[model samples]
Target: MSYINPVLPGTNPDPSVCRVGSTFYLATSSFEYFPGVPLYRSDDLVSWEQIGHCFNRESQLDLSDTDTSGGIYAPTLRYHDGTFYLVTTDVGGQGNVLLTAADPAGEWSEPTQLDVPGFDPDLFFDGDTAYLSYAHGPTLAETTIKQATVNPDTGDVGEPSELWRGIEGTFAEAPHLYRVDGTYYLLTAEGGTHLNHMVVAARSDDPTGPFEACPTNPILSHRGHPMQSIKATGHGDLVDAPDGTWWLVFLGIRQQGGHPGWHQLGRETFLAPVEWVDGWPVVNGGELITPRMTVDSLPGDGSAPDRAAPARATLATFDDETLDVAFEHRRNPDESAYSLTEPPGSLTLRGRTESLGDSGATFVGRRQAHFDCRIDTRFTFDPAEGAEAGLALVADERHHYEIGVTRIDGTTVAIVRLRIGDATETVVETPVDGPEHSVRVDATAEEYRLSYLQGDKDYPEAVGTASSKYLSTEVTGNFTGVYIGPYATTGEDATSPASFDYFTYEPTADE
Candidate 1:
């Protein structure tokens, strides 16, 4: 069977996985997005469908004051007995939280605050004894993998002790422990999370151990291959399939052009094969990970090409009463600002005083999973003097590209705005005839083109273009990818609301 890399694309970083019988469950960090951790289910390990979010309610997650990429960190998903447990760190709010559910796709229990120190929390069960592993310390130089016995139900934790410090690398974190054949193995990611990132392993007779480093350390890395398409290969978790094969699901970013070029889609979740040699694990037969792979066997039939039941082409008319699981808001949104039945068939956004530059804005976006994709939407907005509503491609609060219509001097105008670093500028502005207009943004490996359709025009005219590198993590110094969707803001003096007719996201063939 053959499948593509990045089984989970877009901003799906810090992937953690576990299996139950023939089914596999995975979860990833959501950062500042409202729904904290995104959960997925896969039968073949190649195709995955987003089942639900662990933190779907406002009470469960609060990102109201979080900076870009400052809310939820790495999450570990594991199944113990008949219940599924998800443990993660809320970077800026609650320290650490553990949540459980009987059904992986159903509603989860409320957060059980754990007294664990550090982020990237993982839970390992060995015959009713629950052990927790996490990265601890204030600075990267002092960072180490710490393990502790914890009561998963009562949120009580024992004192944590240092495990392995990795094989002489900085930021030794993202630890996952496993017991195979009476041997305890601790795998970790080191060398930060950029081009220098790598995966290392250690083994011992016990979980908390004076462990010995693997003979072949730094088992998986693309650091030395500076120009490789895949870089920063680390933060991995291992799952034993029912077919008696071991698989590794990790996080990696795809580089576009030059050495350490740029990746705007964020760190994606990738899959590779694992094999045991002697007493340690070897990844991909000692080969570097690439964009595609062909394996001997997968869990189920190799017929899962359309991963999440909605791939390539996505259209939402807001006909349903609630938003789809794919749509996410920035932080804890004012739920009253968004509605689907206000006008019966359209999605309406009641403009807030907060702009895209602030948290809690009236905005909803989907991840830009593919490098070459287009997002199109049509909306009607009669701005109250300074009000504006339209589409945007956002990286964070201070970095994004927007195309919308706003009233200027009693005339409706279509405008394209670009925000990079600390500078904000209006690149294009044209007078329009009515309140309704169509806008779209086309993304390529190198740049993003924002366009708008004029009256009686068959095709959208290009309004402006921006280099994709400006939105990358290297440039923005953040841990999030870009999101494309609709937004509305009143800008303090206006009170008009915006109504969107429909939205579409389609991936195009890369050039």
Candidate 2:
């Protein structure tokens, strides 16, 4: 009956949950990655599976020019009357979009943009009336939670009224509205998304409330426990178990190293039991969250895939036409820039004018879920004058490490490039006699090492090593985790296609 924390790991942040019958569905933010909003299904709350994505097609969402961490933010998933509704903000693109699907695992309907002003949008259904609650801020220092009545079908919204301005935290966001025992409750995350994050609530008899703050505000937070592994606890969603038990799924980060936390895997989903005390919700019995716990009332057979394991290992041959759910591109990828069938069994990526630092670049990758893992890829590229293609360990546009193949002096060579903040340096450059050669990136807890395969041997030649600390959230000051994947870029009109024969990622046992 024991379950580990991070029910969903590695950048799966801003989790929202809803129940349909005995089944539960959870959705998380995808940021700038295309096929956005990863959805999961769990029969017993302990075992979860990726069912589908909410924004799987361009018609459903267009993140073409959105910046990293700017696409989809804080999606609120709710099931109502045989229809599943997803409401969220696009941050830099479309403001707020409402989408619906009959089945949570199937195709969602076209989005209906809402006229709401801010982010972290939530929807609550009561009879024929639907209510929308979202965050509104004049400045980050001063923010307010607001709500309004809305037509579910037409996206028409009534006038919004202030619900709560937050008790003490600066940024009050991620609002979820729930009615328990005929009393409307408003829960929100505050203290921003950093180490001081917390979940607080207010309740009233009316949906649009003159709400009273929970006397014991910040029902859940790790700010007081600096030594605790789980930090930044907030942005919670409540759900009722089949047996009438209540559970809360919230976002939290595991900080490694010393205090004044540093986290790299980004915000992840964590589960906690909830109890109703005097008509108010208390999370994890109003205590600091533990990394592992036993849920006696809920069944835990441990059949679910281990979230700590690398998403994929051995090989990703790109033989199938569809990209795996684990693979994601930066922003909306240019369809013409990538192909699976052109060369058959290999992923062909055409170089573009955009660099890895720019939006809409030709890059696709998976999360670096494990701190100690080996990621390698074999590719053949005949670059045009100024084109490059290779493997990248990306923290952000400005902070990443790349070992790529590019043409230099009429010869193709494997080069290791480092981009930390405003500095960019080429640390290694070795001539590749053939077009097909395997490049490997190995990451330990301390550093990331780059190498190349020689004569059928794995990583026979060493390139160099870079400190992993540079790719952490503490150094980048970004809200995303690192992604290890392939990238291709060109200058101006130059176009070069790089075909990846295969890619592999295996986590070390000790890590």
Candidate 3:
């Protein structure tokens, strides 16, 4: 059977996996997005479904004003005894917090804020004793991996002990401790989270060890291999399948357009086979990851595709009381700012003082999973004097493109604007006589085209276009993928509301 590289695609990065009985559960980072820490479950590993978010309730998580790529760092999902534990760092919120649930898909308890003073927290349970491993450093260049014994029931932590500081490269973080065959093995991702990322390992006979680095340090890395499609490969977790097979689930990016390190889909979850050679773990036979891999099939599972394909053609209608799992907000959104049932079949978003460039914007979006795709939405708004409401494609606070309708000089107008670095420019502006309109943004490998439809017009007219490269990670120097969705701002009281009819995303046929 052949499976895809990104078992879970899009912005699903910093993956951590664990097995409970025959089912496998995975968690990934949801930086600056509400309902943080997206969880997925799979019986066959090849075909996965989003189970639920760990931080679903407002009380469970608070990411208010967290900068882009600042909230919900690397998360480690592990099942101990009969309970599921998810430990992670909330960068700009409550520091380190631990969550637990009886069922992986059920509601998780409110976070237990730990005293740990670092990021990328992992929980390893050996019998009744539990250990917490994390990365501590003032900056990425001086980071160090540390560990401490902890009580799972209480948030108390023991004295921190220094562990391996990585054999090569800086930012040696995302540490996972495991006991294999009567020996302790510590795995870490170093060389930063950029093109030079790599995974290295060290082993000892004790949990807190006088560890020895593997002679073949950096056992897995795609660095220096520009021709390879997968780059910046690291931050992996290992799990043993029910069939007694070892698999490595890690984060990697798929570049396009002959670009060596340019990626718009963000870091995605990738899977590869793992084997033990001379008591050391070797991944993918020490080879660069490919887009597809052939593997053994699960015994009775046949829903998996012959090959993994990119996500395409999705429609999100606000028909239910709750938003879909794919929909995400900038940060901790105001509880009173959005509603799905108020208008019945429409998503009503109330404008606020926050703008797209602010930390707490009333914006909802999903990852731009595909490079070549079209995103369109129908919205109706009668804005106040200074209110603005419409759609946006965002890379970060400083880099984004927006198509919005605002009241300018007592007239409702549709405008397309672009923000790059410290400069902001309006690409197109048109008067909208009516209160309702449909806007669309089509993205190619090179540029993005903004268009709209008014009244009963059968075709959308082009409003403006902008270069796509300016909104890329290479240009912005940010660690997030692009998100497309609706937004609203009133510059003050923010009492005006915008009603969205529906949102649709369609990828090009060749994507």
Candidate 4:
């Protein structure tokens, strides 16, 4: 179904959708946020529910010190012979590995290494033999496509085989290979992954072609459309409806606030109908207002919210499973490092040496959803040794906003400031009576003011503020989403416990 905005907002890109019977599952490429890839489920593609994560535990892929925008790239999701599989490139350094599961709801198998070169791999299984479609080298730099036969049963590649390169213009990265009837179709993204992006398709009778471009190339796009809803559209996947109808799911940006182009939600999944006209797929041809389409014959039979997010005032006591859409680390996530079965109700985040600037702490945060939002958290110190919990909007270490909580001589004080590149804003410190303190901040499209509630009382204590000063795609550009997570900078003594009662995100309830 066509969604008003991002059904799952904030920095979710390179979305890979797969249908298992009536159930639909989606996974996105998470660079730097460890646990590698996150898996989501939906009965109706419109309202999505995050079930469980694929890399909930370690052993899937190795992640450590991989900087923001490092590690994983575009990943492919496919269902073959009763098993669900995800194959991806370690764009940070190591190349490829394939992980599988009996069911998307179950614990995925340990990642199986694949001997292949290139990043942004998409998997297509025509039969028992599976094919991985990828753009090696640098997608923009290479402007090429490659394929290899992988045994679905073993998750191993036959050999590294070369496919056709993009001789024609507007045929670059995000290569997806589709076989229709007796012909093979290779769909790709061009003009980069932003505004100028377009979907181009080529075909050949052979899987390894001498492929020919379709007459109506760039089958779908909003290149010069009148509507401001769609821009930077590309990196898509195709799937068949239960009734045999053909549709395509691609990423698009919907501007929020008065800003109509730059997006906080990196790329959202958008759908358009495709009809095979003369052996070629046609996507929203010659249309200025590319309308949002639907798959169901009738809308939901009442009783369900039209994509309503649960009402939230504070982050603690949150019950939506707290899905970490962009949580990844150097090694696989250790369930024990942080326990889901915490003090019965609260989220217990163990103090880890996950360095601040050099690396980062284990974190899971949603993409920034609005021009303004607030983040609040409560954590205690270990008397002699206190931990640092940073509430931030991070693109990387270079550009970030950090408000740290630590113990000074046994009393708790809060320090908040803006740190950009090498410059700095005077760190503001507020004294509190208890060792545990409640911190809150007001962040706007233009301003970010950090303040704390004195001893759980909601009022302005000694405050610190910064003009959303570090907010600029040009200054800290990584085509990424902003996040709110807890960190530990308590030197060594890693055993010091840091329990974040809860972390809250408020996207401006009213004007």
**CA deviation > 4 Å runs, candidate 4:** 137-140, 159-161, 167-171, 223-229, 254-262, 285-344, 349-355, 360-364, 370-372, 382-387, 408-411, 442-447, 455-461, 465-473, 506-511
- Those runs of model 1 whose alpha carbons end farther than 4 Å from true positions after fitting are 302-312, 458-462, 492-494
How would you encode candidate 1's per-residue C-alpha lDDT over 1-511 as one tens digit per residue? Answer: 5667888888999999999988999999999997768889988887788888999998888788888889899999999889999999999789789999999899998899998778888899998799999998889666888989999989899988988777884698889999999999999999889888888989999888989999888889988898788899999999988878899999999978686598999999999999999989999998999777777767776555433323535689888887767788888878778889878788998878888888777899988899899899988778877788999889988899899888888887888999998999998888877777889898899999988875676433438899999998888999999988899988663378788999999888732
443-508 per-residue lDDT for model 3 (tens digits)? 886788888677676433338899877877788887778889999989666477899999998887
Model 4 residue 239 CA deviation (Å) reads: 1.2
Backbone clashes in model 3: 0
lDDT tens readout by residue for model 4, 1-511: 3334344555667878888877778887777776667777766555666666676654565666465677777778888777788887876656777788887777888777777776777777775567877776453566577788887557677766667565454347788887888788888877677667777788988776778988876786667653566677777777666656666667776554444334444565665556688988887443432434433331233234343322223345533464343333434444555654555455565656654454645444555655567887776544335556645656566666767666666666677757687876747766556657566767776666777664646546557776553554435666665665665555554465566666777778531
Residue 376, model 2: Cα distance from true site in angstroms: 1.9
| For every candidate, C-alpha RMSD to the true structure in Å | 2.0, 2.4, 2.1, 4.0
lDDT of 3 at 466: 90
Best by lDDT: 1
Q: Could you arrange the candidates by lDDT from highest to lowest?
A: 1, 3, 2, 4
Instruction: Give lDDT tens digits, candidate 2, residues 301-391.
Output: 3454432312435468899987767788877778898899979999989878888877767889987766678999988877866789999
Which candidate model has the greater lDDT, 2 or 3?
3
Model 1 TM-score?
Answer: 0.96
